[model samples]
Target chain A: MKLGRHAFGDDEALMMAIVNRTPDSFFDKGATWAEDAAFARVAEVVAQGAEIVDIGGIKAAPGVEISAAEEKARVVDFVARVRDSYPGLVISVDTWRAEVGAAVCAAGADVLNDAWGGADPELVDVAAEYDAAIICTHTGGVTPRTRPYRIDYDDVVAAAIADTVAYASRALSAGVARESIVIDPAHDFGKNTFHSLEITRRLDEMVATGWPVLVSLSNKDFVGETLGREVGDRLLGTLAATSVCALAGARIYRVHQVPETRQTVDMVWSIAGRRPPLRAIRGLQ
Target chain B: MKALVPGTLALLPSYASIEDPVAPLRAACLDAVGRLGPRVRIVSSAATGGSGARVGAALVAAGGGTVVESGETGVLVVGNGSATRTEKAPGHLDERAAAFDEALRASFAGVDLELAEELWADAACLRDLPPLADAEVLYDDAPYGVQYWVAVWA
Candidate 1:
């Protein structure tokens, strides 16, 4: 798969570390809200062997409304700084606004991770304009930043597959390179715990669609709710969910912890026979 | 021409890891096997289709040679020393393993088959080969608690 200037083999599973620039983001909770703190996060994730750094301005939860200009202000310069320092890392700006997407792309972002599932229709056009990869997500047609209330689906996996595929087709029609488009089942974006759980269980169906699948299961509400744990204590639960998605052949993982997720994915990848052991001489020798 | 390579299954491609644990030994074995003619006969005590025989076939194929039952130009012997050289060895530590291997290093004849079997040494097919003193000893070590040697007599 190609992410702007970077190309990877089909069998590779990538770790996209989450770097929040929002003061009120759910997980970090303003820990990296300052520009320098956010920059430090980029460096940390790069050092931890992350293939991509996904920077986000506004919190996914509904709170203070951030303007497109504010979003651009939060991430565009930060994206340029990360790009200049780490030329090999894939920079992904998590935004659904076409304006924010275009600005970050100009600042050398390789991917536009629209966590809201194409709330802004022109996001894909901006991605095509910059020749950047776009993440098409399934959100059950809910409005951006709103939690799912009484959201019902006959088959959550089927709905996710259909919606994400259609969005991917839309991105393709907008001149985005076929290999540069990725589909995601945006866990907990417009999904409750059950919907997210079902999506994780049937992720192979989405993988079978031939588009590389990206999973954003990083300490989300679904895992916390499933395990009856708070956000800060949900890492083990998140990793368990990550293993399920990885075994189903998810190509990209948007994660909060890079090293743990990388180990989990690599172990699952080897178990699935997509990768060989590092130095296996136990009994063969 | 004659070559000797250990019957470790790690030499087979199917048992390979991303970072090879038997790289030096594999290189030595392949280099020795390549000096043999296009068709070579394999002499091994391992049962047919066993890991030892498979490793021998793979090395021969990798060296641009084929295994043949008749009309062979050279012979390839698959055997190894004791597998109980250390506490972590497959058969665990054996007090007599090092002395037995040292004796075989001096010459291949007069091997005690019962003692070799007790120590988990695959030396049954090694009895007829010339001593290491008369051949080019490419490798001789026990890296993973299992003694192995790669030698060629031309």
Candidate 2:
């Protein structure tokens, strides 16, 4: 399952755990971002089968400052602490800032997971400069409180791929190669729950884009809305969403509860990959 | 009043430059369960094969989940992709319908398909047009017949 600069074996769907150092992140508030919390959580989630640890500072929930320099400084300490603490781990720095990306790269971060489809075009340079793998996720406007679930595109999957391709083209123009990048359909970023469901439903189609797929639907608000529950209560919904992601050919899953999501991904992957390759298609349906 | 069949869910319609009927399937499934009960699950199951029998055979080889019918709240949403051709008979669908139908299952999302949502919950699920009989025959060609993965339940 190795995608770009990162590596995830096919033993199961890759389990990338969330280690939010920020106080306002939707889940795991101040739990793992603290220096002490980092040490404990790294061991816990890694031991629980998290091959990748995504550490981030600040919360991108709605209405937060979307400033670049602020994002960089917040995670500088995060990257330094995690990279130093987990010498052998694959650390993914989650941000949409080139400066933050450059800083994390300076601190030994192995990958960059951008919520925007390389939201910062300059991120391509940072990724290339740092020799790190970059996962270009789908991005749309944020309404922190609500996740819209409707059809902006008659086919969300196609739009996702086209947007990703355009982003990839931009990254390529910026000197990032195909092997250095990955793509996500921007699930829940600009979508409501139903739209998120549609993204999940049509994921395999996105994989057809050929970039490795990194799915980060861990306990997101869409799951919260779909299950008619809150973040903590949406574990089952999260598991189901992960299962669907795995089955839909997502190579990576960004989740808060690594152990459980990893187990679920393994089960679904074990069942899905043994057969023929996933049928590939185009456009949105 | 449209149905999305399975192979259609594979982005075939997208490849063919068609609109996937997933939203319509969502609409149809909601309508079916709303008009009936709320236990039915809408699963956009995807599979590949040439005909219903062929795809159904592969689905069996690949393994099948539940048999969907119009009982209380059991029906498979004919799957994804854009509208291709139009036909007006039961089982008059393109090749993808059978393949999608074979692989459909329940959503583990914990969604009570039998229930409705506050938003976009008023969508309808029509098995066939006035001229078409079975959902299978009319896989494509409806005014809003975007394909989806087949939906199934107990």
Candidate 3:
């Protein structure tokens, strides 16, 4: 798959580490809200072997409304600093606004991770203009930043496939490179616990759509509600969901913990016969 | 010409690892096998299509040679010493394994079949061959708690 200037093999599973620039993001809770702290977080994830860093200025949940100018202020310069320092890493900006998308792309972002599914129709055009990759997610027609009050689907996996595939085709029609387009079943975005769980169980259908599948199951509310755990305690549940997706052939993982998720994916990849053991001579010898 | 190599399953390509655990042994085995001429005959107690015979065939093919039943240019012997050299060995440490292997290393003739079987050694087909002192010993070590030797006689 091509993420702007970077091209990766089809068999490789990538870890996209989360670098929050928001002061009220759910998981980090303003830990990396300061620009310097966010830069340090980028350095840490890079040292831990992450291939991509997803920088998000606005929190996903409903909170203080951030304008496009304010969102650009939070992420544009920071994206430039990260771009200048780490040329080999893929920079993905998580926003649904075309204005923020264009600004971050000018500052050297490689991917636009539209977590709210295509709320802005012009975001794909901006991706095409900058020659950047776009992540097309399934949000069940929910508006940007709105919670799923009583969302129901005839079949959650089918709905995810239909919506994400339509978005991917729209991106392709807008002149985005076919290889640069990816589909994601956005966990907990327009999904409750049951919807998210069904999506996880049937992720292979999304994988079978022939566009590379990306899963954002990184300590989300679905995991917390499933295991009766708080946000900080949802890592194990997240990893369990990650294993299911990995076995179903999810290509990219947007995660908060780089090393732990990488280990989980590598282990599951080997189990699925997509990877070989590092050095195996136990019974053969 | 003739060559001898341990019939460890690790030598097969199907059992290979990314970082080969038997790299040194594999190199020595390939070097010895390459000198055994074009058409070779494999001698092993393993079933005709078994893993040991497969390793022998792979080595012959890798050396740009073929295995034939008749009119062979050289003989390739597939067998190994005791597998009970240490506590973690497949046979789990037989007290008499070391002495039996030491004696067999000096000469392949007059092997005690009963003791060889007890020690989990594949020595039945190792009989009537020239002693190790008469060949070029490319490798002689017991890695992975299993004794292995790569030797060539010209």
Candidate 4:
């Protein structure tokens, strides 16, 4: 699979570390809102061995509206700065606006992480124009930044597969490279706790779709509710969910705790026979 | 020509890890096997289906050498000293492991098979072999609390 300038082999798994530029994000609220602080976060994740850094200017939940101009102001220059600093890092701008996507791509962003599914139809066009990668997420047709209030699906897994695959097709038709397109089952976007659990259980079906699957299960609401833990305390639960997805062949992990999540995925990946152990001796010795 | 390598299964390609646990040992084995020319015979304690011959075969193949049933070019012996070097070792700590390996380091011609078996030593194959007095010792340490050696006699 290809992520912008980097091409990965089939057996590889990637960690896309979340570097928030928003002050109102539920997790790490305002910690990295300052540009310098965000840059420092990028440095930390890079040191922790993350292959990609996903920068988002706005929070996912409903809040004061952020215009395309404001989103561009938040991420465009920052993307350029990160690009100048880390030449090998895969820089992804998380926005649903085609305008902001285009601006960030021009400023050196490699991926457009449209976490709200395909709310903005022109987002794919922006990706195609810049030769950037796109993340086709399954948000169940919800408007951007809106919470899933009593959202129900007969089979959440099937809906995710249908929606993300269709979105991927749309991106492919829009002239995006097939290898650069990725599918994400956006957990808890339009999913209740039960729905999120089922999607996690059946994530292998999404992998079977033959697109590189990206899972954004990083400290999300599903883990919080499932284990009766609040935002700051959900890392263990998040890693538990991550193990399930990693074993089922999810190629990319959008994560908050880079080192911990990487360890979990590497361990599970080895257990699934996709990766070799780091060093093994015991009985063989 | 004759060479000796540890019978550790980790030397086999099928048991390999991303970070090789036996890299130095493997290098020594391959260098010795390569010097043995194109065809070599294997001497190992493990039965036909066991990992001893498999490890020897893999090293031989990697070194561009083939195994021969008769009229062999060289001999590849697979054996090790003891698995009870330390408390954390596979057989736990045995007080006699260090001295037993020391004796084999001096000479392998007169090893007591019953004592070797009791200590979990795979040196039964090395018992009838010539002394190591003239052999070049390539490797002689136990990184994982198990004794291993890679030596060659030319």
Off by over 4 Å in 1: B47-49
Write out the backbone clash pairs for model 3: none
Interface RMSD of each: 0.7, 9.5, 0.9, 0.8
Tens digit per residue, CA lDDT, model 1, A1-285: 999889999999999999999999998999999999988888899899999999999988899999988888899999999999999999999999999999999999999999889899999999999999999999999988888999989998999999999999999999999999999999987788999999999999999999999999999989999999998999999999999999999999999999999999999999999999898888776
Point out the higher-scoring one by TM-score: 1 or 2. 1
> Which residues of candidate 3, in runs, are more than 4 Å off?
B47-49
lDDT string for model 4 (A1-285, tens) is 777788889998999999999998999988999999999999999999999999999999999999888888899999999999999999998999999999999999999999999999999999999999999999999999999988898899999999999999999999999999999999999989999999999999999999999999988999999999999999999999999999899999999999999999999998998888889887888
Of the two candidates 2 and 4, the one with more favorable TM-score, higher being better, is 4
Q: How far off is residue A9 in model 3, in Å?
A: 1.6
Candidate number with greatest TM-score = 1
lDDT of 3 by residue, B47-152 (tens): 2236678889999988899999979998999988988999999889988888888999999899998888888788878897899999999999998878898999
Model 2 ranges off by over 4 Å: A1-12, A63-69, A141-151, A275-285, B1-154
How do these models rank on TM-score, best leading? 1, 4, 3, 2
Per-residue lDDT for A36-152 in model 2, tens only? Answer: 776688789878878788877757666466466766766777678777777778888887778888888898888888876655668888877776777876655334333444537
Q: State how far residue B147 of model 4 sits from its true place (Å).
A: 2.6
Task: Please say which candidate is ahead in lDDT: 1 or 2.
Answer: 1
Local accuracy of candidate 4 as per-residue lDDT tens digits, B1-154? 9999887888888788999988898888888888887899999986324678888999888888899987898999998888789998888889999999899988898897777877788877998777778888898898777889888898
| lDDT digits (tens) for residues A71-111 of candidate 3 | 99999999999999999999999999999999999999999
Our model 1 lands, by Cα RMSD against the true structure, at 1.1
C-alpha TM-scores of all predictions: 0.98, 0.58, 0.95, 0.97
